[model samples]
Target chain A: MSNQKLFHVAVVGATGAVGEQIIRLLETRDFPIEKLTLLSSERSAGTKLTFKGNDITVKAATPDSFKGVDIALFSAGGGVSLELIPHAISHGAVCIDNTSAYRMDPDTPLVVPEVNIDRINEHKGVIANPNCSTIQMVAALKPLYDRYGISRIIVSTYQAVSGAGSRAIDEMLRQSKEILAGNTVEPQILPVGALPVKHQIAFNAIPQIDKFTENGFTYEEMKMINETKKILGDDSLEVTATCVRIPVVYGHSESVYVEMKQDFDLEEVKQLLADAPGIVLQDNPAEQQYPLAADAAGKLETFVGRVRRDLSNPRGLNMWIVSDNLLKGAAWNAVQIAEYIAIEQK
Target chain B: MSNQKLFHVAVVGATGAVGEQIIRLLETRDFPIEKLTLLSSERSAGTKLTFKGNDITVKAATPDSFKGVDIALFSAGGGVSLELIPHAISHGAVCIDNTSAYRMDPDTPLVVPEVNIDRINEHKGVIANPNCSTIQMVAALKPLYDRYGISRIIVSTYQAVSGAGSRAIDEMLRQSKEILAGNTVEPQILPVGALPVKHQIAFNAIPQIDKFTENGFTYEEMKMINETKKILGDDSLEVTATCVRIPVVYGHSESVYVEMKQDFDLEEVKQLLADAPGIVLQDNPAEQQYPLAADAAGKLETFVGRVRRDLSNPRGLNMWIVSDNLLKGAAWNAVQIAEYIAIEQK
Candidate 1:
């Protein structure tokens, strides 16, 4: 490793779920940062943050906030990223965005390092991190796509409330207690927060994740459908997604069924995934071993298990995908891409 | 209408989630039960249960407990059903079982009333209630199955922990409090009870519902696959299931992708579901309408929404199915089958 001097980094929306993850990941991964900046909305600004034993002050993210910053990581919201990310880029700083605003743009190199690290060099000012559901999926699918030529993917996500934001997580907890106490609690954070309608999430499974499209798929569903195709670089591959928010906190688990163009034995598929980057294989059945959200939370790797061939379809395979949504799905993935970009820039 | 008097009813496992729903259903629907029998395991026996201001004693279920029992509904377990159902059947009582011991048996009729209520008459001794996930699926698919014969089905479930039993629900609550308090607590009841392993169901998801079959599907998953065909009276429809446990306590949701044997218009399919038995449609998109677990919990109807066509195949349709697992998925469905059998026997 070349001893290149480190660059200073700032993370906007520093107190949110994904933002807090970016902070923990920076310390654990030993990201080479000479200094760190913590920024949030005005309400959260001025809060003191402890990072690597040093307290850092958080400031409001404004247009003039990125003069000396070399790189800015964003996960606040689509609106915040839309307003502040370009301003950060225009101020001589490269941005890695973890929102949908820039992901579909042809110019932005939407990246998952394990899937396509080389695409980092193609960044056009702003790099996009694909949806959390898409990132884990394509990471798990890429090795198989390269080896078996995946022609189709059908994914149904069991998502966590933390994915909606910090308040959504709080709503789930508050409502759980209220439900057990035999009190009625109103929901305020799910099925599109701005829609003026709230549904209780306690002891419930809601099929709608984001606002609906005229075609009937929710925005979260469409993001996974389109982002997977864009990241895998296979426009012809069929992708269908159903995104649902369950009463989970950290990890998002998906049941993925894929039909490969080339047929392969189940052992071969397991072996290939076992050797893939950023993937952990926990497929031993004798021990009742498999991936679980409790074990996967706070971890960066995508866990794949319960892998098998579809009983009725000759070319189909079924598997379970689990990853900590806050970490790998959002903050960790954004940071991982930044690391790859930093190494190449060096 | 003839003046035939309706028989008395008994709800086994009356103190549990399903039992509560069964009680409410019998009262609300005004099913003509001359007497209501409330039975439970010996540990919970002797408690006084009040229904519509009438008090009843919770009796311990034993092999000889079926004497003079008109209809005994069993939601206790497969072990309890296996032991007591034969005795109930021999004593001129119709047994409606809500466990897996007899679902796939050749002589037993696995009934989802919307699909094949006629199958109830075919029950030789015990009538099996289809798995909760399977129940919602076939209910939504029955209309589509009749109009356009279904060739295949791929389903991924976002299941509630209450599907496991009451102890799992308690574990979820206890663990959530422990997590919110920032403490470490060992998990005791999730995924499966017989397995020594445990997982935190609070803010998490477990992919393996039951023990894995040699074919890679969990026993819960296999239940969905096998029971769907049997309940629909056709073993030829290709079906696959992936069962997952989320933090939700009451309702089970499914993302079902169906390939119709014949062509289907999206609106026609939605209309068919609207007219189908026991299904409630909430598919208006401009107003942001759809099914939610919070809305369906404690309600007996199966909720269907998010009806749309698949992006890649004109013959394929994707829909979301939601229902309170304790009600339609477990307790009420069993009671309804018992009601059907009582009517058919007369």
Candidate 2:
């Protein structure tokens, strides 16, 4: 602790799609890093990456690997998180898990920093990053919820293929070329990669983002529905999600419908969102301006646009939210949670 | 009919995205034709188009140009249809308008053949083509509405930019290349062209499509909300629409949350969708296969997947609906209705 300043950050799943973005974001945001340890599965171990001119070799991630880490950020699959998070906690590492493994765990704190920074202090060594689609949504909704007291939420997501993983992104590129060349291409990863059914995502929309749970909601949909309630800290809030995957490589966009507890004006609602943390107001209708994935692809801001009242429900508002699924949705979200932990422990 | 003979159809929007495909569909379906008359805006007029080994010259569309034309199919634009439709209808011809200008006119029949083919007979002069987003949705819901009365429909569309026009498709391609090359590109011609706002659609999602109306709904969203109610002939059915423009070029996918008058069994709903005309079932979760835009891009079928009952609401069902926006949503729908008009009148 003598002159060895700043936090020692360990990034698991370092070679993954979101993991790579997390690396870039860390560099761009100038996250405090005393020692950066990169880790991945055994198959991906030994990969070399240069971060801030330091070549860091990816080590095989084992439970014991987290020994001296101060903060562990994870974008690995839920399986990896379920296995390694305890290792992280045991080694005194505050784990920010960017997977569904502990998102709904009653014992764990699911967080979007701008919305629920206070909740991070209650974390018992583990903080859950929400579904990529859910993160941007809650980031945008928190300000509205704080001011308007949202009674219910209904969101339909336009997600990208990269959220499925690196292989899915590759498959999208491969199939897109094949379709352009007028060649027959087999779909490998999409909707869910491990599922027996495959689908083309090069120039199309896929209505399902994750595997369906027995309760009839796809795991992705449930993540948004449950995470919204958790992040917003309103368990009684009525939330529903219909998640769909589009061909974009990054950014998860959502059409979020909300019912407020009190009457409000559209101008006031826009003002609240504009002032909200992590939110960028792109809602000037006269200019035909709003958020789009292409614009939000590399950015960290959650874009909100097309704010208006619901015709059927006067108290309800509908908005379009778009953010880079890899950044704001996954990697950046995990990093922010880690930062939140740091800020709170201070 | 004078000679008791049908005229060959020349699709003017040919060689263009919708035009090229309409040509292929017309040939595949074997639409009755004795001679084809291809017409386009002056910029594209006089271009030689090949159809079934026949070279057709695309003449400039004019009000005096519909002479002897029995059926004129249009998907060019509102201006083209507005200028040429009266001429077509006045000269013993039927015009199928695939534009916004005539859709809300009380006299025009907004026809989705599967849903309201009979309405074609009531056309005073022209038949209106519904929005690409509206067409597939109403087609899928029609069968359900027929089997069990629908009470409400809350649809959030993940639409492709190809619906905005050829220039938008070009812009998406242009913007993607620029982003991949690490260049910042500005957006133009999305949400609404007339509005001051234009956004990058390359890797983004824009919630505002079309202009805002008096009630806060964009023209695109209002089209879906209004058109759905009108097509279903049920003013009482609650409909809320949030239309978004994504980077996709061909398909318009929807995350439709529907409330029915009766509770439905999962298997029974599958059977109904299977039996429904023009609808394809792709909802096998075990295989991870479902309807996707890339797969639906070149195909002329509406796909339904992720069929599941809402856990909390007994009457609510959440499903994914996807189809090529160019085909079932716009161009092909117009052509199909035109074919039906040719046949049913005989």
lDDT per residue for candidate 2 within B43-160, as digits (tens), equals 9887897778888888877777777888878778777778778878889788887788799898888999989998988989788989889999999988889877898888898888
In order, the Cα lDDT scores of the candidates are 0.85, 0.81
> After aligning candidate 1 to the native by TM-score, how far in Å is the CA of A62 from where it should be?
3.8
lDDT per residue (tens digit) for residues A1-346 in model 2: 3343477889999999978988887887777687889999999999999899889999999988887899999888889999999889989999988888998999998888788777777889888888888888888888778887988787888788888888887887777667555688887777676776676776667667777787767888888877788888788888888887777777777888888999988899999989988899987666556777867878878989878887877897888888988888888888777665555554
Model 1, position A234: C-alpha lDDT score:
83
TM-scores, each model vs. reference: 0.93, 0.90
Per-residue error for B46 in candidate 1, Å, reads 4.2
- In order, the first chain's TM-score in every candidate is 0.97, 0.96
Q: For residues B1-346, what per-residue lDDT tens digits would candidate 1 score against the true structure?
A: 2675677677788887778778888888777777888899999999898888899999998877788877888888889888888889888787888889899899998888878887777778678888899998898899899889999999998888888888998898888778777898888877688987777787777777888778778899899988888888787889988888887777888889999998878878888899988999998877777887767888889999988888878887888899988888887888778677667756
Q: After superposing candidate 2, which stretches have Cα over 4 Å from the reference?
A: A1-6, A20-35, A47-53, A177-184, B1-26, B170-198, B211-216
- Highest TM-score: which candidate? 1
The RMSD (Cα, Å) of candidate 2 is 3.3
